[model samples]
Target: MEKPNSSNALVCELINKGTREWNINNLNSWFLPEDREAILGIPLSSSNTPDRLVWAETRSGKFTVKSAYALALEEKVHNTRADCSDESAGKIWKTIWQLRIPQKIKHFASKAARDILATKSNLAKRKITPNGMCDLYVVKMRKQSVICYGAVIMPKKFGRIAGSGVVIRDDAGEVFAALSKKWKSPLGAIEAEAKALEAGVNFAREVGIREAEFESDSVVICNALQGLVSPPSSVVNVLAGIMNEVSYFRQWKFAHVKRQGNVPAHLLAQHAKNVEDFVAWRADCPSLIEHACMQDKM
Candidate 1:
C-alpha cells in the first residue's frame, strides 16, 4: 500500500520495517526518491542494510524504522480477541493482573469502573412524579417581563420553598393586596411565577386595582421576590428587571397557598402546556369534562 501522509510517517516506517526492512537494491523501488530523502535525509546507497535502517532514531525521539504498525496491528487483534472472550478470558486477565498489580488497587479500580457504568445507565431516563401535595401554578401575561409562569409545590411540607412574601398596602394596612406564585421545576418555576405576578400587577394597574389579594402556590417564588432566597438561575436578569419595574406597584403582597387550593393556577399551567386547546371560562370546563368522559368509555 502507498505510504501514509507525513503526519503518519511513523506508521509508514513500521510498515516498511515489517516488510523485512527493504534493502537499497530492491527497497529503493518501493519508495519514491523524494520519500527516501525525506525519511533517511539522503539517497539510498548499495551498502545500506536492513539493520542500519531498522534501528535508526529520529530527532522527534521516535524509532525511525521500528515495526510500529505491525506491532499496533497485533495489539489490536489481541485486544479484540480478549474482549470477545467471556469468563475464561476475564479470569485469565484477572489472574495476570493479580500477578502484576497490587490486589487492593485492582479491586478498587474495578469497582470504580462498575460505578461509572451504573451511573451512565441510570442517566438514560428520568422519573417525574406529580404528587397532589404540590400544586401546579400558571399565569397570563401581556407585556410583562415576567411572562407565562407555572410550578407545583407542597406548601405544608416545606415552610419556604424559597420565605416571607412581600406586603402590598394602600393608605392603611386594612386595605392591602398580596400575591405569590409557585411551580414544579425550581429553576423555571420562579421565572414563570414572577412573570405571572407582573402580568397580574400590570392588569391590576390597567384596571386601577390598587388594593387586592394575589397569592401563588410557589413559596420558593415568594421567597425569591421578598429577597429571602438567592437570585434564581434560569431567568435571573429578566426577573430582576421585572422586580425593578414593579417597584412602583408597592401595594402588592406575595403569599403562599396549598396545592389543593391552587387549582386555578394548576389549570393555568396545564393551559400553558397546551393541555387546554381553548381559553375560556366555563363552570365545568365542558371540553375537558367531555374528553375525560370519552377516555372512560374507551
Candidate 2:
C-alpha cells in the first residue's frame, strides 16, 4: 500500500471498527495535544454520509481580487487612522472601492494609498533595509476571468470527517457554481484546504475553462500554489496533484484570504457534513448559501 501522506492518523481510520468508538491507542499514537483534542472533539455524524469530491470554478474557490481589495481597503483605513486620528480618513477605503474606475485600477489605487511602495520605512517593514526607496510591479476579459474561493472545515463539533467547499463566481461577482465535498479520510485542515483547490481546478477544467484564478484561506496552500514557498512535507502529494491539474490551464493565479472574505465557501464546507447527496450547483446559488453569496457582492 502507498504510505499514508501524513504522519497524523486518519479520523475515519481511528474508529474502533466493530465496537464503534475511537481507537484510543491510534489517537494517542498519532497526534499532539491540540490535534488529539480536536480529533476527539469531533461530533459523530448521524447521517453516515459517504465522503465526496466535487469540483467547480468560474472563476472560483474565491480568494483573490475580492480578498485583496478588502485587505487593501482595511490596511488603508487603519494606516489613515493611525497617522491622523481623523475619522474622515476611514472613508477612503469606501471611496477607493466605490470608484467607477475599472476593478484592476481601483485595486492599484488602494495599494498606492496603503504606502505599499518600497519607501525607506516600507523597506524596513519588509526587513529589506535597502539604501534607497524602491518600486515594483484580464483576461478572456470576462469568460476567461475565473477566480476561485475555497474553504475547509475541520473535523470538530460538526462531524468526524473534514469537509471543503468551492464557489466559482463570474467576473461580475455572481455565483455560477458551488460544491461541498467531504474528504475521503480524515485530513489535516491544510490538507483539506489543498483538496478544496484541487476540486476547483477540476471543475474549471471540466467546463473548458482555459484560464483561472484560485483563492484560499490557507496562506500556506496559496503560497505553495504560487511557488512562493515550498509545500509542507505532509501535503506535498496533494499540492502536486493540484499543480498537475493547473498545468492544463493557459493561465492561473493563486491568492490568500481571511476567513471572513471567504464566508460563502466556508458555509458550503460546513454544509458538507449534512448533505445527503453530493452535487454541484450551476447557474444558481444553493439556498442555504444564497445569502452569503449575495453578501460577497457587497
Candidate 3:
C-alpha cells in the first residue's frame, strides 16, 4: 500500500497484459513477498469480467438480517454442542425450549416434563379446577389421527418452484410426524397442492400411519378429492396418485382448512425453501414450526 497508487488499484489491473495470468512484475512491485505469494496462490477465475461481492447465505446475492440471525443461531448451537459432549444427549430439552411458541407454552412444557404440571392430582392440592385442563386441551381431543398438508410457492406470486409441508397429529393434538419438502417447477398452484398431499400420504405410509384424516388448505384440491368438484387437468394425475395411496388406508377422509387454521402446515411449507428433497421428524416437530404449531392447535 505504501507503493504509489497501489492502495486504490483494483485486482484486474494486476493481471498480465496479454494472458489470463497474474502480472508477476506488478505483484513484486506493489506487494511484499508473503502478500505476493498469497495473491498468486488465490485461484483466478476463468472469466476476465470484473469481480463483485456476493452473499453466500441467500439464493439471491443479497443479505438480510433474518438470514444473518439464523446463521448466528446455528453457529451458536453447533459451538455449544461441540463444547459439551455430554449435553449432546440432552438436545431433547433444547428442542422443547427452543420451540417457537410463547414463553407460557414453554414453561408449561417444562413443568409437564418434570411432573409439576397442574394436572388433576396437582390441582386437587391447589384451589384450581379439579381436572386442571384448559379449554384448548379439551377441545383438541379427537377419535383419530389427522394428517394436514399445506403448500406454498417460494416467491408466493410468480415462482415456479414450491414447498410442500405435512404434519400428522392424533385427535389429542399430539404431533406424530412432520415433513417439509421442496418441489421443482410445478405446473401451477393447484398442482402444488396436489403435490403436497401426495407427499403427505407417502410420508404417512412410510411412517406406518395406516389410517387417518387427510387435511389440506387448498379448497380446490380437497373438493376434487371429495368428488364435489371435478379435478382440474393440471392436478388430475397428481390427485389420482394421492388417491391410489389413500386407498391403502383402511379409513380416510379429506378435510379443508383456511390459511390461519393451517399455520403449522403452512409454515412448514414455507420452511421447505430451506431444505433439499425434504426434512422429516418422528415423535417430534421441527422448531421452525413450533410457534405455528401452537397457533394451529389453539
Candidate 4:
C-alpha cells in the first residue's frame, strides 16, 4: 500500500480494510514499517470488537474543539520552526491542555499561550495607545467598599464528593480571601452552587464586609439570589440561608458570569476534590490558582 497520510479518513480506511481488527498480520500490509510497529504496540482486546476512533489528545477519548484548534496550531508552529526538533513549546501546551478543569478555562489558557491578549503592556509594545477604558471602573466607583466574590461547585463524580470553591477580591482585583470545601455527600450542581453562595456570604460576613457582590457561573443560582426566579425545593433551604446572610450586608448583589470570568473559583473547586477537608487563605491566593487570577485581572 502507498504511504498513509495523517488524515482521519486514511487511518479509518486502513483500519476498515484490515478486517476491522488491529492484529499485526492484518495491519502489516497496509501501514509503513514504523506505523505498523506503533500499531502493534497498542494493547488490543482479546475478544472480537469493532474499531473505534479516539482523540489521543484528550483523556476522555472524545473530540473537542479545543483539541482541533491545538492540532492546527501545532502544525502551523511546526512548519514555521527552523529545526522543528525542539518540543518545549509543545510540552508546555500539552501540560496546560491536560488540565482537568473546564474546557473554557483551557481555551483561555490557549489564547494566553498565543499572546493574543491585549494587555496594556502588550499594547504599549505594539506602539498602540490604550483607550484608558476599564470595564469594572463604574462598579468600582459606585461602591468603593464593594468587593466581588466568585463561587463555584464541582459535583460528585468518579467516586469524588461535591467540592465548592469561593474567591473574594477587592475592587482592585486583589484577592482578600478564598475557600475550598468538599461535601461529604453528593449534591447536584445547582444544589452545590447554592451551597457555595451561602458559604461565600458567610465568609463575607465573617470578614465584616458591608458591601459585596457575589458572582457565579450558574445562571439559575444567580437568578434565585436576585429573586428573578424561585429556586427549586432541593436548594430552597440553601437559598434561604443565603438570603439571610445577604441581610448582613448593607448593599449586595448577585450576578451571573461566564465560566471564563470565574476561572479562579473554578480551579479552586476542582482542587478541593483532592483534599480531605476545607482550606481557607487570607489576604492571599493559592499558588496553583495564581495564573487564573492573573488572567482575570488582565
Clashes of each: 19, 11, 0, 0
Task: Give the per-residue lDDT of model 2 (tens digit) for 32-107.
Answer: 4434544543323222334432211111223456546656675776577446355686577667678885443554
Instruction: Estimate the overall C-alpha local distance difference test score of candidate 1.
Output: 0.37
Where is model 4 poorest over a 10-residue stretch in terms of lDDT?
136-145
lDDT of 4 by residue, 1-298 (tens): 6443322225445443333334434455444443443343233222233455556544334667987887677657645652324599677767877988655456555545555344534433322222333222211000111333333333324342456677778888898888776554334345556666666777778777788877776777778778887655445555766776677789988777666556677677777777886888888978978998888788
* Residue pairs clashing, model 3: none
Cα deviation of 145 in candidate 3 (Å)?
8.0
Which segments of model 2 are wrong by more than 4 Å?
A: 1-146, 154-159
TM-score of each: 0.31, 0.50, 0.49, 0.48
CA lDDT, candidate 4, residue 175: 85
TM-score of 1: 0.31
lDDT, candidates in the order shown:
0.37, 0.57, 0.63, 0.57
Ranking by TM-score: 2, 3, 4, 1
The order by descending lDDT is 3, 2, 4, 1
Q: Summing lDDT over every window of 10 consecutive residues in candidate 3, give the lowest-scoring window.
A: 135-144
Better of 2 and 4 by TM-score: 2
Taking every candidate in turn, the Cα RMSD to the unseen true structure, in Å, is: 26.1, 20.5, 24.5, 19.7
The alpha-carbon lDDT assigned to residue 135 of candidate 1 equals 33
